[model samples]
Target: MTTIALSQEQQLALSNLCTNIQLWAKELGFQQIGISDADLSSETERLQQWLGKGYHGSMQWLEDRKKMRLNPELLHPGTRRIISVRMDYLPEGSQQIAILKSPEKAYVSRYALGRDYHKLMRKRLALIAEKIKQDAQAFIPELEISSRPFVDSAPVLERPIAEKAGLGWIGKHTLIINQHAGSWFFLGEIYTSLPLPVTEVITENKCGDCEACLKVCPTAAFPRPYELDARRCISYLTIENKGEIPEEFRTVMGNRVFGCDDCQAICPWNKYAKPTCEADFQPRHGLENSDLLTLFMWDEQTFLKNTEGSAIRRIGYELWQRNLAVGLGNAPANPDIVSALTSRLPQASELVAKHIQWALVQQKNPNRKRVRKLSRTRV
Candidate 1:
C-alpha cells in the first residue's frame, strides 16, 4: 500500500479532524466510532483457511473477492484509514429467548426485527464522508478525500476491522463484542484516503474460558471457540443458504423463521447490551411477538406488505415461507399449524413444498419434541 506523504501540519489537521468526526458521528446516532489504518494483513490467512474449508457454505462471493477483502486500497483507491462505526440495534423489550422457547412463536433475529439497517447506516456514513471532504478543504485546499461507505454490502472483514479500530473484540460467535456494549450492534465503515491516527486496540479478548455461545448453538455451528462453521450455522442455513434447510438442522432450528440469535442471546456480556434509541431499529408489523402459524399463513402479497422496509424482505417470499414452514414444524403439533402447512403445499414451489411436507409430518406426530438446548438466562 502506498502511503500518502502529508506535511506535518496536515497530519496535525487530520488528528483534529478525527476528534470532530467522532462528535459528528455521535450526533448522527452512531453509538461509537473508531479509526484503523487500512491494513488487514493479520486476517488474510484466517480468512483464507475459513474459505478453503468451505465453511462459508454457498456464499461464493466471499471467495470471489478474496483480494479486495484483504486489501482496503483495492476497495477504494488511495485508502489509508478506515473509520469503523457501531450502532446498537437490539430493540427494547426484546423477548428473544421467550419467543424461542415458545415453540409457537417465530424468533426473527433481533437485528432483523426492525427496518433494514443498510440504508440508515449508509446514509450516515455518507454524511461523514461529505463532512470530511468539506472540512479537509480548509486545511489542504487541493485535498481529495477519496471515500466510500460500506454496510455489509461489501466483502470487507467487518469484525477484524472493528477489532483493530478498538470498537470490540470478536467473541466466540465471531461477532464483535464491546466490553461495555456487548454484541447487539450493527457495524458500518468508511474507507478513505485521510491519514487519520489509528484508534488504539484497547478491548482485549475477554471471551476467556467462557464458551456459553458455543454451547448454546442448537445446531452446533461452532467447530471450535472463535471459529464459526457457517455450514452448520442457523443464520446461514436460514438466510444465506438460499436452498434447502438440511434435515438435520430443521428439527433443531426451533421457531427461528428468519435468522437465529442463540449465540448472541446466550453470551453473558450481552447483559450489558442496551436497547437501541433509534426508532428505525425498533420492531415493526408485530414481528417481535408474532406466531409461526400466523407468519406462515401470509400470502406473497401480504408478506411483501408486512416486510416492506424490513431486512426480511431480501430473502423473497419463497425462502420466507420455507423458513416459516420449518418453524411451524418445530412448533408443537397443532391442527391450525397443520392446516396452514397443508394450505400452502399445493401452491408452494417444489423447494418450499419439500419443507412443507417435512413440516406436515412433524405436525402429524404428537410425540415430536423441539429439543432446544439454549435457555433464557438474560431475562
Candidate 2:
C-alpha cells in the first residue's frame, strides 16, 4: 500500500486517462462507466447494521467477506480507485407481467433468462483493465499497474461503489437505479492502483415519495424505505435458500420460479429502461415466456443442457424443480399441472417432494386465491 508520488503533469495525464477509459468502456459495450475512490468508510456502519439484523439469511459468504467488501484495499492490495460500469440487461418484448398473470406460465427473473452476466461482464472488464494498464504504462513507463475485475462473483459492494462513482443512486428497493436507464442493468468494476480522477458528480436519489416498489413486493421484503429483509425476500428464497421455502411465502410466491422482479417492475422510472443491445443478454430457451409445467417437465439432463452458461444453472436441478413446484402451486389448478406434480413426487428429492406435495394441495384446493394482482402486462 505504498503511496506513489506523482508530479502535477503526471496527475493531469492520469486524469486524461480516465476520460479515455470511459470511451474504451463504451466501445466494449458498457452503457456507462465512472471512477470512484476506494474509500467505503461511509458504508461500513450500514453493512454492520444489515448483518446484525441477520437479514442475509443462509448466505454466509456475505458475512465472511464483510471486511473486504467495505475496504477494497483489503481485498486487493494497492487498490486506489474503482472503475464502475453498468450494462443494460433487459431484453426486448419482455412479457414479464403477462407471464406473471398467466399462472400456468413460469416467471423467471429477467436477469437470469439469458446467459450468466458474470462471465460476459468479467471478460469485458478485464479487457478494459488491460487497456487502462497499457495506457497508464504509456503515460508513466516506470509506474507499476495493478488492477482486478469483478462482477457479482466477488464480495464487492458494487451498488454503493456504483453510487459513489456517479453511476446511479441506490433506490428504495436497494437496487441501483439510473434516472435514464432504470434498474435493468448489471454492474461490474475494476479495482486499480492507478491514480485516476474520480467522478465528482454523484447521482442524486430520485425515488422521492414513490413507494410503488415497496408495496408491489409479494413478500413485503422491504421493512423500510432503504433496508431489505433478505430472509423474507422471494428472490433469496427461490435462488439463494438451499432448503424448503417457508410455507408462509409459498402461496404468495406466484409463478416467479427463479427470481422476483416486482420491485423493479413496478418502479415508474423503468419506463425509460431501454432494451439491451447486447445479444448475450437476450432471453434463451424461451425462458422469458415459459410455462411452469413446461419447465417442470425438464429432466436433470435437459435442465443442465438448457441452462448451460445461464445463471439459472447455479441453482441446480433440485432447486429449479423446487421453485417451479411453488409456481405451479400458485397457478390456477389444472388437471395437467396436478398430474405433473403427482408424477414427479416419486422421483423428486426429499426437499422437492415436499414442495410437490404442497403444490398438490394448492392445486386441489379450489378456494385458494392468486396472490398477485394482474394489471400491468410488462415489467
Candidate 3:
C-alpha cells in the first residue's frame, strides 16, 4: 500500500474528507461510492488467462494495454487509492422483456435506450475529484493532490476495483451485483493520490446456484461461471465485431439489434434494481419499443439523426442495418418485412448485403422453425 506521512490533524481531516466525498457523490447523482487501495495482483492471472483463450475476440486494445491494466500506479502516476462510484441507469418503461418477446419489435439494451452514459458519468467523476482536491488544500497544504477520472475508458480494471471498494460482488455472469442495487448500473472511477481509508464493507457473493443468467443468454456467451467468450456474445457480435456476424448465431440473435441484456434481465438479483430519474437515461427516439421493420426502413440520414446522442451511434448505420437484418430474419415471416429487406439489399454494403440475403431466405421459408442455441422458446 502506498502511504505518506501525515500529521495527526491531517489524518483526522482526511478521514472527514472521505465522508464528504460520498455526500458530494450523492448530490451529483451517484447512487453509491466506495474507496480502495490500487492493488490488483490477484486479478492479473485471471485476466491473462481470459485473454490467452482469445475470449476477448477482436478487442486488441485489451491486449495492448495488458501491462497498464494490471498496474494502477503505471496507468495513472501517483495513484494510491481508487474511488469507485455507481449510477443506476435502468430507465422506467423500458419494457425489455416485452420488446424481446415481440420478434417484430427491436430490443435495444436498456443501457443504450437513452443517451450515452460515458460523458455524463465522466463529468460527475471529475466533479468529485475537484471537490477532493479543494478539500485537501484546506486540510493538508503541505501535501499536493493529483487525481484522474475515468468512465468505461482507458485501461482501468473498474469492476475489480469496484469489488475491492465494497461497491458490490462480481457475480457468476461476470457483472457486479449489489445486494441492494442489483446489476443494472454503470461504474466510474477516480484514481487519486489521497491515502483516505479504504471501504471496510466487502459485499458477499449471493449468486449461489442460480444459473438463470447463463441459461437465458441468446448466444450462450458464458463459457462457465464468471467467464465470458466475447465472440459469441450478442453484444459483441452486434456492436464490436465489424465484420459479418457468424451465421450460426444469427437465428438466435432475435431482435436485439444494438446490444443484449438477456443475462441481466433474467438474473434474480435484478429484482432489487431501481429505475433512474435522470432524464438523460430515459428512452429516446421511441427506441424502447420500435418495430424491427420501422428501424430497417431508415435511410442513413435518418439513422444518424435519430441516434445523434445515443451509444448506438457508435455502431454507425451499416452495422445498424446489418444487425436489424438479422433481427428481421428471426421475426415471424411477413411480406412487408421481405419487401423492406429486398429494397435495402441493392444499397447495402457487402457486409450488410449478405445479412439481407440471409433474411430473405428466412422470410421465404415460413414453415421451418429456426435453430436456436438455447432451449428457451423465446429465441
Q: Each prediction's TM-score against the native?
A: 0.96, 0.97, 0.97
Count of clashing pairs, candidate 1: 0
Candidate 2 RMSD to the real structure: 3.1
What is each predicted model's overall lDDT from 0 to 1?
0.89, 0.90, 0.90
Better of 1 and 3 by TM-score: 3
Model 2, runs deviating above 4 Å: 373-379
Q: Candidate 3: lDDT of 151?
A: 92
Q: Assess candidate 2 and give its TM-score to the true structure.
A: 0.97
Clashes of each: 0, 0, 0
Q: Candidate 3, clashing residue pairs?
A: none
lDDT of 2 by residue, 144-263 (tens): 899999999888999999999998899999999999999999999999998888898858899999999988888878888889889988899999999999998888888889999999
lDDT of 1 at 47: 93
Q: What is the TM-score ranking, best to worst?
A: 3, 2, 1
What is candidate 3's lDDT per residue for 1-379, written digit by digit as tens? 4456898998888899999998999999999999999889999999999999999999999999988888998988888999999999999866788888898999999999889999999988898899999999897776678999999879989899999999999998899999998999999999998888898985788899998888878787887889988998999999999999998889989888988988899888889999998999999999999999999999999999999889999999999999999999999999999999998888889999999999999999958686656543322
What's the lDDT of the predicted structure labeled candidate 3?
A: 0.90
